[model samples]
Structure formats: C-alpha cells, structure tokens
Target chain A: MVLYLIGLGLADEQDITLKGLRAVQSCSKVYLESYTSILLVDDFKARMEALYGQPVTLAHRETVELEADEILRGAHEGNVAFLVVGDPLSATTHSDLILRARHYQAPGAEAPTPVPVKIIHNASITTALGSSGLAGYNFGQTVSIPFWTDDWRPDSWLARIGENMGLGLHTLCLSDIKVREQSIEDMSRGVLRYQPPRYMLLPQLISQLLAAAREHQVDFLDPERTLAVALCRMGAEESATRRGELVRAGTLAEMLACTEPDEAQRRQDEQDDEAFEEANPTVSEKEMDARREARRVQRAIDFWGEPLHSLV
Target chain B: MVLYLIGLGLADEQDITLKGLRAVQSCSKVYLESYTSILLVDDFKARMEALYGQPVTLAHRETVELEADEILRGAHEGNVAFLVVGDPLSATTHSDLILRARHYQAPGAEAPTPVPVKIIHNASITTALGSSGLAGYNFGQTVSIPFWTDDWRPDSWLARIGENMGLGLHTLCLSDIKVREQSIEDMSRGVLRYQPPRYMLLPQLISQLLAAAREHQVDFLDPERTLAVALCRMGAEESATRRGELVRAGTLAEMLACTEPDEAQRRQDEQDDEAFEEANPTVSEKEMDARREARRVQRAIDFWGEPLHSLV
Candidate 1:
C-alpha cells in the first residue's frame, strides 16, 4: 500500500496539481489534515468531489496528533492519501508523522513498513507573501497571536517583531484561529460547551498588535512608519485585497467592518454552494433557489468600504 | 498610464496568473527584470509569447539599474509592465523603483509617474523549500553564493548555516546562477568570454558545504543524519522534483545521473503527444501517461560522497 501525501496550497481547490488530483482519485480513503492552516475557500470538498468523485474524510488536529494509527490502519490494502493545506511537511507535526511511518515499517506487518510515500508540492503562504516586495531572506521569526484574554494577554510577540525590525528583516505575523473546541466557560465548569469556530480578522489582530506594542514599550514601530500588510480571502476566486503599507487606524477599522461577520457567512455560503453543486441537479434546484436568498448578505460583505483585507 | 508589475513565479510560462497574463497582453511594452533570479524552464521571449502572445524585452542588471527611465518612459504614454521572476516587490530594487515613481509624482509631473502599480503574486522558492518538512519559522538567516570569485572564496554561508543548526533551525542555501553577462575577459580585452549560464548542482553545493564545515571546526551536522531536500523545476508544468532524505555521496551521484539536458524539449514532446491523441480518430488511448521524467541531477550534487570536497 502506498501512502501519498499531497499539498493543497494556499488558495482554492484548483491550486492542487494535476499529479496530486490523480493520486486523490485513485486512493481508497482520503483524509484532509485540517490543522496548521485553513484554506481561505471552503469549496475544497466540492472541488475534490467534482474532480475525483470521492468523499474526503477530514482529520482534524486531534485525529492527526492522537489517532494517527487509526487514520493509517487500512493503508495496507490500497492507496491512502493524506491531504495537507500548504506543503505537506511545512509543519513539524506532519514531519513527525512521516518519521513514525518509517518506524512502523515491520518485517511482516500487513502494510509492510516501507510504504511508498510520495509528496506532491504546492504553493505555501511563506513564499506567497513575497508578493509584498519583501525579500524572502530578510524575513525574521514569525509569530502567531491567539485569541487574547483580559488577564493573560501576552506581549512577547512585540519583542520578536522588534528584533526582526532591528535586523532590517520583515516579520510575518500569522493570525490564530479557534476551531472545533469547547468554550472557556465549558472547560471551567467541566461541561461540554461547543462554540462556533472563529477566524481572527485584521482589525482584532491590529488592535492586539497596537496594545502589545504599547505595553512592551516598542517605540520604534509607529503605525505610520511601520509597514504591515493584511491579506483577506487569499487564494480564492474573488480573492481581492491590499498590499504592504503603513498601518493606520482607519484602514484597520475599515477591514474590521468588512471582514468581522462576513467571513463566517462566506464560509457557510461556500459550504452550501458546494453541497448544492454536488447534489443531483434535478433534486437540488429548490435547494439552490433557497440558497440564492443568502446572496444578498454575501454581496453586502463584498461591497464594504476599504479593500484592505484582500491585500496579499 | 499604469505600471503593471507582474511576478512570473519560479519556472515556466503557465505559472503566471490570468490577471498577470491579461496585464501583459494589454501593455505595449513589457520588460523582464533579470538581475534578481533566473527561471528554470522559460526564457523571457518564450514565456512572453506563450502567456501574452507578445515578445518580451529583456532587461538585464545594467539595463534595469542604469536605464530605469527608459522602462518607465512608456508608462507615461500607455500601460507598461515590468515582469519579475517572483513577486514584483520581492526584491528591494523593484521597491526602490516604486519609491522613485512616488518621487516623480511629488514633482507634480504631467506624466503618470507610474502611480497605482498593480502587483501580481506567485509562488517563490523561499516557502517552496518548506516542503522538506522544515518549519518556516525554524529557518535562520538565508545567504547566497556567487559563481565567480578571486583567490579568496568566501565561506561565510557556512557559519550562517552552523548558527541556524545551533538554534535547531534549517538553513536555506540559495545556490549561485550567472546569466546573460559578458565575462571579465570580454570587458577588459573586448573578447566575449560568454560562458553558458550555470546553475550550481546539489552535489557541488554539498561539497562546498562539507569543506566549509571542516574549516569552521563544526561537527554538529552529520551528512547522513542531516535532512536535506533538493527541489528542481519548481512552479513548472513539466516534472518538478522534490526529493527529501539524508545526504550521502552515493545519493548525490544517483540524483545527477537522472538530470536531463532540456526541460522545454520534454514538455514539447508531451504536448505533441496530447495533440496527436486529440486528432486521432480510430485508436482509443486507454492509458493515461503520468510518468514524471527524472531530473535528479541537483539531488546527486546534494548527496556527494564523504569527505566531499578537498580544501585546496
């Protein structure tokens, strides 16, 4: 049995290569490794279904980190493909998995430990960010900002960004996302409190950065002098937006106003669109008609003030 | 008049996006920026013809750095596009041009002053190297090697790589490329010592790396244990190879054995085969030709034998 690892790149479903598409088609079971990063567009499932005529099982962070053996259990019988957003091995977790696979190869194991593993490469955000005209080599340590807490807001990221700027290097700040997890309230009460997933928007990120900078006394980075880029709807069909420029309150406010609610709605609309597109045409007509009612909300979000978030 | 800055990714013609292609199509004059990097598969003329149905004017280092006004002159009359290998702004030199355009605007010139420059982004090798299971954040300072040198061959890149390893980070070593320039002999004696543009193979790079390590007295990295990935023909339609493994002389030798002379020729043959299939009336082509040609020369160089290079 062959273990095929494929990189789905940063953008929409089509960002995958012809080679990767073929591997997914022939695989007995395909698992989408749903951590490290999320694809801006949610039509990935529909696109994969359209191209390969197969349902893809999503392997979230828990499944990959904990239940990896279960994910690879049936690989000995036929082809098993694991799809990862961006390049397969960009994240340390995936690399650890590859090492585990190597260790699991036994003399008489059904899957014969030496399973042929092939990686199909695609575009990663690290390289894609170069569009801002920043030299790739001049980039310093990258940091992520988790959803802030009133008592536990960390300002360590400011130090890192300061260090990078000191060396004349640019800092790539990745926003955090909370997905498929219980709320803080639920965890404190020992009860299951399932909350909706949230993608951090540019406004919140900027505000946090500002707050952190102020608290850390990072006087060098003023909003007007320091250049920052916010990318929204990256690698999507309607992928429109901003480039690197000096950070301004007006720009951040504008980005927030457009992205805050619309992002969630866009995700829902994309999911419904994929489902509608995948269903039998005759039966899905009514559903498609019903889905059209949500287009107004989508349009409202699309026409919002500044296109700051769309900047690559 | 607008300055349309387009990124031609890493490899061949098809790597350019539909928007970039359109920008190139509408522009009367297009210049390919050549100093920053070299494309593996497509030349300026060939890519321009294939993507935009026009011939591209090649702007070498001197042409761009010295004769910038000539390239910008057309922007005042009509749309002008500067085609860069990666993203338009990835290099500081292009950004400097943009700043110059802003200066022109400040003078209140009647000309367009290249305002409202459009940037088209594409994948770069910086993040492409992350496919080796190396974390983007884990990479330290990146350095490049030049082709020609005097008696003193600089080995500072070795120190940088060692520092990265000390921090448990991977090093991205950009190999040297010498393209489209008259040699020293040509300038001094008026005899063109035009050598074929050379791309450092993986074996050569590894050899140098080993020698540098010995000189620096660093034994932290074991060629067999150190993970190295060699990527060749990135962002191209034809065979793009990404091989990851421990480095050794035998491995490097094997990789070199597979390198091909002409990638364009192979792609042309494949296209021809596809055209033949479409035109043929009788025979049913059941087999999908998915055989990826081997261009493993870079890999061979990466894994050169123990005591890789003798320090002269």
Candidate 2:
C-alpha cells in the first residue's frame, strides 16, 4: 500500500503523464485537490474518471486540511492517489501532506508507521511561463498576490519584486484564487454560507501592483516603457501572451482593453488596414510606424478569447 | 503542418503526457534533442520508439544547430515532433529553435512565412527540485555552473548566488554538460575530432563554488553549519537528495563520503548500533545524544544508492 501524490500538469486531464495515469489506475481511492487552481477543461472529474477507470473525489481545502486523517487512513488501508492541478510538490500544503503521511498513526496502532509515499512530477505554471518567450533561468523568487479586502492588504510581495528587479531578474507573480470562503457576518452567526469563487485576473493584479508601486515611492522605468508579460491559460490551446506597458490609474484598463479584440473585429481591422495601405501606397514613414505598432499590439493579443473576458 | 516541441518529462518514456504521446504518434518524423541533459533511463530511444511506434532520430548538437533547416522542412511538409528531455522551453537553445522555426523560409519562397509551433510542456529539473522538500516559491534566479577549464574560469554565477543569498532565497545551480566538443589541438589542426563528453558532478561544482567564495571574500555562515542540498536523477526511480554542510578544503570530501551508504552496509550498521546499545544499557546522556545524531544522518542518507555514488 502506498500514497501517490501525482501531478496533473497545467491544462486538462490529457496533460497527465502515462506514469501518473498508471498510478491512478492502480489506486483504490483517488482525490483531486481542487482549491488551489482550476483546471482548464470542462467536466474535468468525469474526463479523468473516464481516462483512469477510477472514481475521483474532489478535495476542497477543508477536506484536505480537516479530514487529512481520513485520507491518510485510506492510504493506510490500500493504495491511494492524491492528484494536484500542477506539479504535486509546487505547493507547501502538498509537502505538508507528504510529511503527515510519513508520520501518520493508524487507529489501533501503538506506534507511528510511515506510509510509502511516491511523487509523480509534472509541469508547473511557474516553469510553464517560459512559453512567454522569457528566459526561465532569469526569473527570481515566485510571489503570490492575495485578493485585497477592506482591512486586509499586504504589500510584502512588492519588496520581493523590487529586489528581483533591482538585480535585473524577472519575478513571477502567481494570481490569487478565493474559494469556499465565508463572509464575516455569516461566520459570526455560525452560518455555513459560502461566497462564490473569485479568481484574480490580470487587471486586478495590475491595479494592486500599481497601487503598491505608488505607495512605496520606488522609482521605476517610464510608465510607457515598463513592460510586463501577461500569460493566460498557459499550456492550453487558448494560451495567450501579451507584452505591454504597465500604465497607471484609469488608462491601465484602456491599455488592456484595446489590445484584446475579438476574432471578427481583428479580421475586419486587418482588412481595413490592407485597403488603406493599398489606397495610400506612398504613406509617410511616421504613419507607417504607427501602423506597425498597432499590428504588433494586435499580434500580441493572439488568443485572448473567453479566458481573458473577465480581465476587461 | 506543425512542429511539435514536446517535453519528455524528467524520467523515461512513461513520463511523456498523453497529449504528447498522441502528438508523437501522429508525427511523420520524431527527433530527440540530446544535448542539454541526459534522460534517466536505459535504451531511451528504443523505449520511446516502442511507445510511439515512430522511428526516432537522435538530434545531436550538430544536427540541431547546423541542420535545423532540414527539421523545419520536415515540419513544413508534414507534422514533426522534436522531443526534449525536460520542459521544451527551459533552455535558451530551444527558444532559438522556436524563433528559427518561426522565421524559416521555404527554399523558393519570397518571404519568411511563420510555421505554427506547438509546445507541450513537462516537468523540468528546476521545478522537480520541489521534491527535495524545499518550497518551490522560495527559489531565486537559477544559475549555471560551467566546467572551469584552466585559464577560463568564470565566476559571474557567484555574484548571482550572492544576490539570492542576500534576499534569503534558494538558488538553483544547473550543472554544465560538454558534449561533442573539439579540443584546442583538434580545432587548431582543422580537425573534426571530438573530446569525450563531460558532466560537471557535485564534487567539481563544490570545488569551484568554494574557490569563488574564497576569491570573492564574502562572509558566509559557519562552514560546519552552511548546508547545500544536492539532487540527482530527479523524477526518476533512482532520484536522491542529500543535505550536508559545505566545509572548506580537504574535509569537504570526508563530509560527503560519510553520508552515502549502500543498503547492505546501512543495514549492517544499524544492527551494529543496536548491538552496542544493548551491551551498554545505561549509556550516558552524551553517548545517547551521539547515537541520535548518527541515526538522523543515517535516515537522511536514504536512497543514495547508485545515483549519488559519483558525488564522492
């Protein structure tokens, strides 16, 4: 009997490695830890069950943290599989699980007996960011930005980013995800009400980042020239990468908006541009430069479809 | 027609994702890029060929660098798969390949028409280091430690490590691999003769790091207390990690030597310790403390079997 911590890669169920799939098939009980990050495909559980020929229980944060003993007991009795969205070891919580598995005591056992634990590695978003045409080796520490509430705003990640930037290194900022959270009023009244899931998009991340930048009074490159690479749904067919400046205040939304155009609008713009170019064959170099810039922006917005709609 | 740059994950053929396997099965040609790192399996090409049912070609440095046009042409005619050991984009050379593929032109084409390139990501050694029980998010910029030949020792990586240490971040040092290299004499004689392939092991890396630390005159924690975690054959069945101190000069070898134990020897040692403890039933607290320390060291030496033997 063993506890297998398997990584389900960055995208859909197809991203699971053959080794991981084999392990899942061998396991009697399988769990997909679902609160950290969302998978990119629909009917994920059904698809995974179909592929692995095994039933999978969705383990929310509470299930993992509060009912870890139950999961460990399953491993104690038979082979168990714990599936994660990205690399299994990418999160501290999973590492803690491994540690707990090592020290778990059975109900009637006199002493602690370690469970045989095995990890199946897979692609993580931190390394998958290399798809953005940025050098992965140049990236410094990865920082996460939490969704800000009225009384809970933290800017420690800002200092880490600043340190990385000062060292001429890149910083990977992991977006926040809020899931299965109860409101303060509901918690005080001993209610079991939960709020809807909220995933922090690039717009919200940018707004918080810009606010921290201003409050810290750090001097950076010119607003128009300081570029950031925004990646959405990486390792999937709908993956998109955009390199654009981090403009401050209200214009930030406008800057993000113009670059993201629907496919029909983009096609129409290309046609209109070609027609104009044919009509004005002897256009000025300055105007041609502006057209090139516009095209560059348009090309950068390659596949910002439904996934990026919330950013607007 | 498309060029699929698929990652083969860290271990063997079984580490390839289902999507990657399907893509390879559909490809007309498959080439395994075999320079940056070595796959941790025997008969790698044969195993992959068996799994994919496609004839596999080993693409060495010369084949990829000097004959990329042929690969691009293969993609232009039909789908081709270029398999990499780790994540496809982890290395700059692969990024260059992607760029070249984008800008490649057919022999008689008037302009460079971009060919669609798809990257199927997998587990890279960088992210796989999370198995060492270190937080992946705490890692700083990754640096490379090249083989230090006489009269050509570079220490720029020292500064980068120092920067990371200043920020209290872990630095990942990628070991260098020298394959298909021509010696100075061979190059001077206009010969095609090549030198034997060389991999920078932990001992050599430690030697160079200590030299850099001394030359730079940087203050570090006590040598007995300062530790380094060395990982080998990650994401494989033989993967091993050892945490030991970075002592100076001669004793460094002794420190590394004492920790690595073969299974039989480890079992024998445990039996010997038990026998001694039983003989001396009322041992002093100081002797008991030493026994505890020995057990901790022995437990930490877990699974150092065949993989870490080279570290000595």
Candidate 3:
C-alpha cells in the first residue's frame, strides 16, 4: 500500500487521466486538495465523487500540513489517494507531504520503513498558458500578485518581471488566492477566524501591477504597448455549457476591460470574431443583446473562476 | 468542422486524455506532430494507431509549415486531429500552425471565412518538472542547448541561464533535437538531403555548459556545487512495465556520471531494492560479466531515449 498523489487537470472531473481515475477508484481513501487551487468549476467535488463513486474528503492546508499523521497512517495500512488541482506536485506543500511520508529518511539512518508515494502527472496552468499564443520557452520567472492592503504593498515582483522583460521573455503572473485566510490579529490571539475566499481578478491584478510599475518607475514593460493575454477556467473547452474564454488584448487595460461585467460591448465586427459575425448574420437584435449580456456575464465569472495572467 | 490541436501527454499512447482520445477517435483524419519532440517510446506512431484504430499521418516541420494549406483545407472540410507530444502549443510551430489556419482573418473586411482551432491540453515536460522536488514557480526562462559545430558554435543561451541563476531561479534547459536537419552545404546546392537524428546527451551538454561558463567566467552556478536532475519517459509509471527513473545529484558533473554505462553496483543491503540485489548476489562470474555488458547496452539506449534536462 502506498500514498498516491494524483493530479486532477485544469477544468473538471473528466480532466483526470484514465490512469489517475483508476487510482482514485480503487484507493482505500480519497482526498481532494482544496486550499491550493480548485477544479475551476462549480461542484467539482461532487462531480469528482460522482465519477469515482466514492466520497472525497476535502484536504485543507492545515489538514495536510498539521494533521497529516492520520492520512499517513491510513496510507501505511492501505492505499490512499490524494488528489490535487493542476499537477500533483506543482505546489510545494504536496512535495512536503511526500517528504513527510518519508520521515525516516530525514534523520534516522536505517531504523524505520518509509511510506512510498507515487505521483500521477496532469496538465497544469503553467503549461496551459501556451494557449495564449506565447511560446512556453519564452516565459521567464513566474510571479504571484497578492491583494494590497492600506499599508502593505510589496513591489518586489516588479523587478523580477522587469528582468524577464529585459530578456524579451514572457512573464507568467500567478494571481493570489486568499482561501480561508485569517487576519494577523486573529492569528496572534490564537483565534482562527475565517474570511471569504478571494481570488485576484485580472483587472485587480493589472491595476496593482500598474501601481507597482508607477512606484518602481520601470520601463521594461509599457502599459499602452505591452501585449498581454488572460485566461479563465483553463482547459474547460470540453465542458458542456460553460466553456471558458481566453482574452488577448493589445494592452493591460484592454485585457482588463475585456472581462468587465458592465463594459460596453465592442462591435461584433470589430472583435476578433468578424468571421463569427459573418457566420451568424441572421441572429435577431433581441437575441443578440441577450447573447451579448450572457457572454459578458460568462466572461466575468470565468475571469473570476481562476486568475492567471501573462505578458509577452 | 474544427482543427483540434490535442496534446498527447508525456510518454506513450495511454497518456492521452479521454477527452483528447475521444476527439481523435471522431476526427476524420489524425496527424501526429513529428517534429519538436517525439514520444519517449519505441514505435510511437504504430502504438498510437493501434490504440486509436486509425492511421496517424506524420506532420513534419516542412509539411506543417510549407504545405499546411492542404491540411487547413482538410480541416475546413472535416474535423482534423493534430496530435503533439507533451502539450499542443508548447512548440512555436504549432502556434504558427494555428495562426496559419486563421490566415483568412488577417485581411480585408470581407476576407474568406476562417476555421476554428480548439486545443486540448495535456501534461507537458514543463509541468512534469514538478516531479523533481523543485517548485515550478521557481523556474526562469527555459533555454535550449544545440549541438555545437566548428566555426558555427553559438553560446547565446548561456546569458539567459546566467540571468536566471543571478535571480536564484531554476533554469529548465531544453536540449536540442536534430531530426532531419540539413547541412548548410547541401542547402547551398539546393539539395534536399536528410541526416540521421541526433539528440544531445548529458555528457555533451554538460561539457558545452562548462565550456560556456569558462568562457563567460560566470560565478553564479558552480560546476561542482550546483544540483541537477535528469528524467526519462515521464508519465510512464502507471503503465505496467516502463517505470521512468529520476536521477538526482549534488553536482552537475556527478549527475553526468550517474548516467554513465559503468558504475559500481551498490551493496545488496545498501541499495534501494534489497531483494533484487540479494537475488542476484553471488551469481557466477561469467553471468555477472554478461549482466554488466547488458547494463552497459541498456544505458546506451536509455541515454538515447529523449533529450531534456532539468536543474534547480
């Protein structure tokens, strides 16, 4: 019996490979890693359970970090499957899990046996960024943008992005996700208080990035001339209804506005889909309005689905 | 009808996702993108054909670039599945193919109609690098190492690697693969001659890297202190027989020698598999000699499998 660290690819349950699904189906216990990233769809857990025909326990950060002893014991006794969004080992936490499972390998020389862990690879947003028409090899260091507070604004990521830009390389910016976060005061007082989940939207990220640029006065990237692409619900094209969207804009502001819920619609002919307009010329006025509104809402939610931006 | 750019994940046929496999099954014609990278297995084309129950046409660089008009026309007529190893758009060639497929959208307001291309994502070596204990977020711009030639050697990739090292970021080096490369002399004569494929091995890559370091005199990465890891046949563990090996070393030079044909076998009790070593312990001297010879041959072939190296 071993610990199976499996990756559930970007979109939904069906994104799991046949090999990964087979591991989940027969494992003694199943866990869906929740804190790092979600499956980019509503009811991801339920859908995964339906596919596996087994209940899945949510593995929060604390559960996997502080209270992993129980999971390790279960793995020692029987095979246990731990599913993570994107690639299984993308997050250092999972790698730490594998390391923890091999506690004996740390200090003890030859005393205790170790619990083996097998990794099943899957598509991660890092690689999926190629869909933006930027070559993966051209991408430089990946940076994360955190939500800004009144007093705390860190611009360290700007210099890294500038370095990448200096080399004419694309930068992959991973937007921050505040999931079940606690305030510093609450943590200091030994109180565990929950805050609403927050994902950094493209608009917020771009705005913050621009602010950082202003502070740093860096010329590596230009706000008006820079070409950027944004993705939401990556790898969800096969999903029945809510197929995701990839938005490429001439500038950061344009890309941000492309997903704005209340932004005025660009003329269909002026958009990237003149061909689409040509294909559906007979669409009615009211139907077109409804479709535009629906598309706007969809784009907004999808932008809100998962936040990751790239600049080339 | 659409052009489906599907990723055949790292390794062999079963690595294709159910969604991608479904697309391939239903597509009128299937093409396996042959350049960029090949599957890390023997007879990948025949294997995929047997799995899909359809013949897979090889889409070489020249065909995909020069004669893509025919392929594009076919996609307009019916669904065309273009299979790429690792991920669909990881290579710039596929991205160019997608752009070429949309060439109709590049002209006047009333230009010819354009066909749509949908990309189905899969695990790529970029994401698969997480299998090493390094975080993907720590990787900087990926660089490629080409086979060196007299009077034509280029070392420009060293600066990028040096920049990443300066930032304390890991560099994912994509070694070059020369499949059907034409000599300049042949090209000058308007001759279309083909050369055997050549993949950069660890020894040759390390030698060139060391030479570049000496020429540039960069101090960021130490030849003796830098840690490195090598992988072959990623995403193959779930398959019944082929289990890929992850080689880790404390130094680049040590890692190079790790793949050498000859290294003393560890003592039975000291090795990872006590049983296997124990089972083979005290074999006849003649049998041991034959086993060593066979291991030398196996290492030669495995080093020839696929060409990609990772460092952190």
| Highest-scoring model, lDDT | 2
The DockQ of each candidate is 0.21, 0.63, 0.55
User: Which parts of model 3 are misplaced by more than 4 Å?
Assistant: A104-110, A183-193, A238-243, A256-312, B104-111, B182-194, B238-243, B259-312
Q: What order do candidates take by TM-score, descending?
A: 3, 2, 1
Q: How accurate is candidate 3 locally (lDDT)?
A: 0.76
Question: How much lDDT does each candidate structure score?
Answer: 0.62, 0.77, 0.76
Score candidate 2 by lDDT: 0.77
Give me candidate 2's TM-score against the actual structure: 0.80
Backbone collisions counted per model: 17, 0, 0
Whichever of 1 and 2 has more lDDT, that candidate is 2
Give the candidate number with the greatest DockQ. Answer: 2
Q: In model 1 chain A, which range of ten residues has the least summed lDDT?
A: A303-312
> What would the per-residue lDDT of candidate 2 be over residues A1-312, giving only the tens digit for each residue?
899999999778999999999999989999999888767776788998899887889999899999999999999999999999889989888877888899999999999977888888899887677776788878888888888876999989888888888998877787787778899999999999889876666655666777888888876522454567666677765334322212122234444554566799779878887788899998887797788655653444442322321111
For residues A1-312, write the lDDT of model 3, one tens digit per residue.
Answer: 789998888777877777788888879899988898876567877888898999999998899888787888788778899999888977787888888889723233466558888888888888788877777878888888788887999878888888888878888887788888999888899998888787776777788888888877877556677778776667775346554655454687677666664533565424734565578998677766666655654675565544433334
* Lowest-sum lDDT 10-residue window in model 2 chain A: A303-312
Return the TM-score for each candidate structure. Answer: 0.63, 0.80, 0.81
Writing each residue's lDDT as its tens digit, candidate 3 over B84-175 gives 98889788778778878887442334776577998888888888888878888789988888878868679988998888888788888777
